[model samples]
Target: MNKKTSSFLWNLRQLNLNICPFGSSSIRRMMKGDHLELQKPKITYQNSILKNLLLLQSLQKPLLSVRFFCQGVLVFQLEGSEIQKRRLNTLTSASVGKLLYPRQLSSDSQCFFMSDTTPHLAVDGPKKMMVPLEHDLSQKEKQLDFVKHRHLIKHCNSMSDVLDIFSKFPRFSSCNYFISMWKIAKNMSEDQKRFERQLLYEHPAFNQLCDQVMKEAKTVKLQQVIFTLYALIKIGIPQNTYLVQVLLRVVQERINECDETCLSVLSRTLEAMGKSKNVDALRAGLRLLVDKQIWTLEHILTLQTMMKCIGKDAPYPLKKKIEIKALKELDKFSPVNSQHMFGALAALNHRSVILLNECSKMVAADIHGCPFWMLMSILQSCRDLQYQNLDLFTAIADYVTTTFDMWKMKQVLALLLVFESLRFRHIGLMNLFLKRVVDISQSLNQKEILCILHIYSSLNHICDSENQQFLEAITSALNTYLPKMSSFSLLKAVYCFCVLNHFPQEPFNQLFQENIINELLTSGTESERTEYMLHQVNACLELEGTSVLKSTAITLRECSSAPFRSHVDIEEMLLNLLENKRLFLKNVQLPHNYFVDFELRMDSKRSKVFPVSEADAFIAEPDIIRVALLCVSRSAFCFGTTHPRGGLGIKMRHLKALGFHVILVNTWEIKKLDMSLAVTFLKNKIFSQEAFPTAPGFAA
Candidate 1:
């Protein structure tokens, strides 16, 4: 049984039969022998019971002349002449074992016959009646034919069957036929489209047929199904406008139940549509996907393709509208919701010329933080192009200025650094950026002051003698801000100072006064102390060379009443200064522990070191003779050691004492000088070697 039939039977079994009809097969043969025979099989469950009842009714028709066969049994014995006399064949039997045809049973089954002896005997029986009905079997055949047509379409296995059905109907004439075909096409395997396309590509006739079906057809569902399928074909181009319009109409008509696949199809079709440069189709396709909330992978991918197609082709007004709409839509989804936003950004870049204005507004508003990083990356990436638009630049600059206004020092400094790095691109903007950095540095946050200082450090690299005025202006500004700032800020200031060490001493000495250096020493944490100490040492070493140490001792004499220890102990302070200086030398390769004192006993390792600048001359150059004489003078006055060359222990002192500008010379240049006699005097005649016993404090 069919599923529907079985289900119907299960529902019908609970009801009792009421006025069911029955008929005999011989009467059916007599009725149908002169009429059209029922072609279908009989409905067996009820047919056999109806047939037997008719036969019984016919057999009882001649029982009108009844006689008693037993005490309680009635026997009907009627001859043909008697039956004709009372019309017994025409009368229906009201008793059992009587034959009745369908029409004959209804006419006589209700008639009552009175027997003369039976009236005296008083025979009575229950009432029985039969009603005849007419049946039209053609309605059943029509219903079966409809069902059979549907079943055939459903199980169609070959293309010939589909083509035959298609040929049987006029183009778009039979709605039901087309609807059925649509359902079938929807159920067709995905490969069917590829197959159809292959057919179209390999066979010109099929292509024409598909085009007619897609473009000029009146069948709406069929049109959409064919158009979407054709789009899926990956073959020759079809009419993009028709496909997009149909899909969009279908999506809108079926609102609240739109298929995601339809949205996806519309999206993929955009690539092909874009090749036509059909802006209408592009807009419609985007609107449909947005409407359906189907920002699927295909949708994003298609957007990327659409972006590439329309690169600079976007008109200003339309571009503005698209920007507003896209941002609003993206805001709805939150750009952070997915990484697809990166793709979206990439698309935006293609339309950047027109988008830059709207983008600037969005960025200036700063309501959405997600796109800021993206915008920054875009600016950096696009820097190489000469045509890099200024809308983006002005937007970023305006954003940084606003950040400065809002006291977002960290953000301002970050922007300043980016601008400074990109100064080579827009060279004219360098001064403006520097001025802004100077402004930010005035109120810079402790966390961000180092970054600003780093920007200055980079700026120094860019500044030449031609731009010396600007560099001097910046240096003067740093001098004012350095003392009151925190330790990290001071370290950053010192770093900036070291980077721009070419400045003259008057302004430099003003920077090194008690307040500035003390601020560095007192406010700086351990790490900052170490860092700045290294910065100072490297700068002073490069600037003064060996004479830096002698200047330190002379500076110590100015601090005479502060404290004094044995002159032999002065080396500790000197070592501390040199170690810290060595830490600041940039890119200089030195041995491990070359600057560290492994024997120092302080809990804080820095306590064993000192600022070499404090114990030596801060000079303009290295002079070997001047440094040697000064070293001799310091050893004679301070250490009083019996060495051949007086104070020869001071190696770099004589170099700077003779007014040498060491900045013009490198360390190796000074090293190759002829100092062999001086070296022997210092190593051998400078002192009588004495070895001590191995006790902690009792060496004699």
Candidate 2:
């Protein structure tokens, strides 16, 4: 027999079918012919037992001997002579109850007896009975019990049952069935309410529920309306949707009826939406709440929202009241609340030692638990306030090292900026961050990629191998993104590369080509174009040690009437001097103040007259010729202009008094003077004669 048939017979024997009214002769008839064939294999144990009992009741043949016991299968022997005994001996070993019968049964009288729990049955054969072991049975039984428990949770009768089951197995709380049931639950405990909030925010079904609630927005209760809107905002729903408008109208209609909590919620919702038709009502509601001394964490949040929404439009008195109240209740603020409070204070440019210290303590206590964006905001607030706390920076660096993978792209960039702003350095952390940036560089836009490069270049330290690797990755990807870069980003990229002294030639040429510089100069505002041109000239000189693009020079010269006229003049003159062989020197300092346009030193030496210790004896000392180019402004040389002496007279007198030759070139005069005339002017000042003749009274 197969294992299935053996299991069935084993179960039947355990059921003690002999206790029934059926005799051994009936049992023999039941086992005869096709009755066993009528029973299909692999039937369940219960069905097998019932079918066997029914067959026994229908038995027609009688038996000579019949024996029944409580624990084993039934056995019968026929009343006939040797024919019956020989027939029984001819029975196959494949019979269902062959294992249950003992071989010692009397054979001469053609009789046998079957009894339950026969000890001699074991000696017949050990492998014939395929009973399962205790361990396997217990394992299967436990699996069956767990399946039943899951079924109960899935088709729970009520919300109370779901809550009970969830309490027992908190893991099941993530189930969709539980989430749906919890949404419609009428009553819940504090813990249940907190769980519901978490589910409503995280569950995928939340938006569908939001759509439903918003569709029936007019009928939703005030409390439900507030919570539904709050949840939607938390989930980042756009505030300008039609549903948002409906919700806003609902809140506006019920504004007067709302208590402090409801008012705070409405204010925050409106603030998040960044719009409100009834500012007066919101301001008044807040004022009344404050007058009633109903300060809470919600009040602080509402105040923050108001500051953000109204900005400078917020009334002075209302702002003052909110600030005072928030300060008074600073002790009760949580980390999240403190973040908002600090953000609001920073926005208004308000600073307080107590508030800042408290915020620092909260953040230091649980830096890892803080949200990435919140941490960024706190860092930003500190930056804006120029507040520095060593403990806070240490905590932030620790958290970033442990949980950087949890940060988003923008957060990572912002954190880097904070580090740069504070001049904080953690070489290992920065190196790891740069590697991550390079890994994700392909996915970043031109602006984002440039930002990373900019941060790296802006650091005050020297470039290491990791920094060089980051640069290589950026330049390799530069061609793909360079075409889409804005002019500002393009300029910044070039500037960064030049700052690092790691210029990539192809991108540099592409970015600073003649057409691009012309477009920038012609299209940008005077200040912007001037700045770009200046940076282009500086970058080219630093990287290539050559003049700027010809088109850039022409643009600068043609835009003479531009706002940065003097600055443009200075740059052109400096570039020209840099390129000229006669004027080029071992050292040159660019103009930094109103007095000097450019300071140049040549290899020529000269002698200067000096007095020895007031003895009135003259002596000559050798000195290098220091020539200062004073680019005279048009206003300074105008006919009506006044000077202590004459026009350009007092400045020349000062230069002569300082024992140095000064060259005064009129702005108009320099515009007319080309490279040779400029070179001639410089040679005269340095070798032949002073460009400015001394006044009669001045000693020289």
Candidate 3:
């Protein structure tokens, strides 16, 4: 308790304070460990920086790092490139033990929970946890791969060259490159965009790619190189279209090397050109290589393929113009060059009027290069387009008639076109055209004669009363042709006669009486000989006089007894004609018959009529006389000809005219004829005594 004790105690207490609450050794050891622990974070920070730098170096960019500590103890480290690491470093403090950059690459900043006081490097201390950096790293990797693969990098060569390389691989071998190329191509300007996309076709780079695959790779699989180019072209390349055009030209130059395999590839590629921005360029290439003079059949076929691609979607006027130009070049082909001819025809099928007009010019030029078959091909094309243009038809008609000497078949087609044109409102031209045909036929042989007759019959369907003049014209033509020509002339005559008689029905009997028909029926060539006989019968049946039918029946009946009867199919045709005649008779009510019915004007009240002369009357005993009159009454009950009443009337009238008395008897006259008593009275009066009815009480 003394001063000395207090001083000693204070010094001891001070010494104890310096030492520690426990032992000095334990305190010193703890401080050393704390120092090591504090230094540990610096080592971690340096290592992390080095590791992050390595990662960033690999990425070729600067990066930032964030260090985290709990109560001055190192806990975790976050590292990222300068993109966000430096930003993260701004808010987080290493001294605070919680260091986080406010702008972090990942949502999660490097964070540390503090249990003891430690200086904060971050301005706003700590914050909500951010998303993991691992996610960010993964995302960046993917972006890198995509950018690398999805775009046409600067190192990439010309699309054509690239396509050529791809062509060495199998189909779809360059899919990755193709996809990349396509995306890049689509990104190009509107002009380049077209061909680029086309290049991306299944045969990628097809336009640019030399189709000549490596000789070593020749044995590779189907669609290998070709399909690769196809794909590349389809997905497309932006700057490669010119290269594409070049490639196409190269292929076209070496087109002979194309087999079906190559041709098939070319066909597909050309089809894609329809929508290509470089269509004109591609077409130019085709034209340049596939010139008309040296064009092979394959080239024509390729041209056809090109046409099909554009034909439908192309504007009609534009397509028509193109067709005109194409056909002009096509027409230079030789007739024997059937391949060109067929191709030209197929192409012209889409442009009928143009073809027809061109054909007319060729015909007018007296150019014999276009063979009959070729001209026929052109005319055949017109059929599909016939209704759209009449000038084409008229020109064709003129050509047919003018060129008939050169191509008979074309004439037939021309006539057909004319006939069709005439079917609607163009009869003048049709008649003129047909007349020319008829006139020409008459000058030609029987074959040509038959052709005209058939043509006339074909046109006869539209004939009416107004066109009856032409019918006579036709008849005249036939008469001239049939008599002049032999062989089938009889057949022609029969055909004409039947047509004229059934069709015109206008006074052909005069021609019939010329007796050429009778002469032919008697003797004509074996061909149509029976048909000639049938014609005579048909003509007679068609005549106004029944005498013709009587004569015809007798003639045919007599002919049946002859040698030719067994050779003819007479009964079948005759019966057919007879049935036709019967039908005609049923429909045709004669003027005389009309006079008897609706036109007849006898007095209504008169039951009996006086004949023109008394000689028309007849007398008889009462019963017999009554019967006669009843017969007359029955006959006077006129109606349709089918009625029997008229039959009896004619008979009674004849008898009456032959001096027989005929009392008029009808329903009303039945009673007047006589009751039994009157009959008895009449009998006694007429018979008198004895052998008669014993005087009915007037004495025997």
Candidate 4:
């Protein structure tokens, strides 16, 4: 065979060995025998033959002979006749034979063949054809001989051959050979390039190639250095290795000499290698380029790389210069560069409404092609900058809704989190997202489950249909994934349920068990632990109609002395007293539009004692007391100005007008009251004559 045919056959052999499901042993056995064999030429084997026939046809070679055996009995053969030759030609031309006679070949039958001769057949029919033994052996021999004489370099043409040669003869290989082979490979098809990359690390000379590149580090051309570094990274070399460090030093030394394109390549190479300490050297190089006025869109991309590598540690001046230059070129920014620019700005926490508007316009124009990650980056930047552009968010939501099914779990969670952070919710988008979560619910991790639940609960409105299905799916997933959840995640989950006023029986029981609750409470900061414990207690109270553990209630009451009780903690304490019947009242009103907190009735005797005339309807009924628990900051009331309608003053007026003996208890004051003290305060308000002391002049 000519060199081209030989190379084709060699590649075919390699592909067959790598991809064939039956393994190389089958191919090896076929090559060793004078005739090929298929023990039970099933449809699958027939399909394999038909697929290989395409490769064989490219060789323009003719089949010589064919044989079929059934249980060692020669059931059919085609040979030594023009009619048989015509049959062979016809069979080769007819690609649909396997489909036509898929199961016609007996399970006991075996097909075999020999090349370079005419077919001899006892019967005339099409069947699965095996590879010719001679051709297979000849190809095998050529491969062996090629390996044996690979050091001579004459047998090497493709990148694979070069790799094989280098693998066997690295000590004798020249740097020129390595460079030339990579250059040749660079021009090959993507598949060939991918195959070569896979072979690169397995090649015996991989380490030697790295060593040679390092040894000639200073002498290699800039392109050679770039190509070498690119290849090393593609081959999975460690970025922090001494070899990479030496290579980086070489690149840095020659960086000033590089043109814009070369500098771009160098920057990307450093990025691909994840080198951050080289930021100073790279920044210096970029400054040289900048001074030379060699900047371009590529430089902007490289700037993003630098930002990612250096993070906030990048000097303010360098970042500002890059930002100014990048913004000036905003109109010229592609979708990809725009993404990087936004990401860089977010990394530095830089904010510019003008730049944001420019980015917004660009993103709006190219939102169709914007990838999931790019959308995430834009949203993240919006959040970091606290820039709320509804138009931009709407466009992203539109894209995500259309492509919701294509998203992975992480992407879905990230998109949901960004939406939640921005407080941007779209019903269609949320429904699609929830459906995806349901489909992949079994695969979701604890963190992802918590994030989804958080997003749902955080939204101001979630349609009941989606909410029910979503909660059900999460409840099912919690059964399987709860044990794997971290204590922090579990706590968040409880809080999420409490926020939504949802607590599935099984998950809540598992979640609020004594040990799990105790573990959760002990692991977080004092505030976080207290908040989580309160959520658990509230969820249990809402879903199970009882206190959590007595210990949990006591712990919450003790921790409630933090001098800043949260709204939930305050509610939990009040509910605990009510559930225990420590502070009894015949009539109680839950929170409503007029009453800010709980309303309770005092004893009848106390009511008669504090009675007022019916003309002054503003006076609260002697039997009634309305409680308002205010968690406002001390500053809120300091200036005698409260927030408009939701403020304490407005609430106090509304409650007093509704005939309530309004008692305002600040959270700071309530936090100082234990269970006994809190009950005492309530009882004192109820029965004490001074508690309802006739408003300003009424008799007691």
TM-score for every candidate vs. truth? 0.25, 0.45, 0.24, 0.52
Candidate 2 differs from the real structure by a C-alpha RMSD in angstroms, to one decimal, of 26.7
Query: Is candidate 2 or 3 superior in TM-score?
Result: 2
Writing each residue's lDDT as its tens digit, candidate 1 over 375-492 gives: 5554554442222444456655654444444534444455556655554222334345555555544454444545644655544434343346545555555656544655444545
Report the lDDT tens digits of candidate 2 across residue range 1-700: 3654555454445433433236556655654543212221211323222243323322312222223212244434333222122222222223424222321221111233232332353433322322332243344344333324345545564444544444444322122333335343435566665665565456555454444444434433575576666645543445666555656666656655666566666666555655445444554554555445435445556556554544445556656766677778776677777767667767656565667777788788877788777887888888787777767877887888778777776876778778767655555567778788678767777777777766666553334767777788878777687777776567667666655556576666776677776666666466655564444444344334334333332324322322323446545555453443333222232321114555554323321211123212222423444565666664453122222112244335434444446666566655777766765554444444432332112122
lDDT of each: 0.37, 0.52, 0.38, 0.55
The Cα error of candidate 1 at residue 96, in Å, is 47
Of candidate 3, the 10-residue stretch with the lowest lDDT total is 594-603
For candidate 3, write residues 545-615 as lDDT tens digits. Answer: 24433343323322222121121122222223222222111111221111010011011221122222221
lDDT score of model 1?
0.37
Worst 10 residues of 1 by lDDT: 596-605
The regions of model 2 sitting more than 4 angstroms off are: 1-257, 291-312, 346-353, 383-391, 402-411, 418-428, 435-445, 465-467, 483-488, 525-530, 533-536, 539-555, 558-700
The candidate that wins on TM-score is: 4
Candidate 4 lDDT, 227-257, residue by residue in tens: 6676566545567777666767777767766
lDDT of 3: 0.38
Off by more than 4 A, model 3: 1-256, 259-375, 382-426, 433-442, 461-489, 502-540, 543-550, 553-700
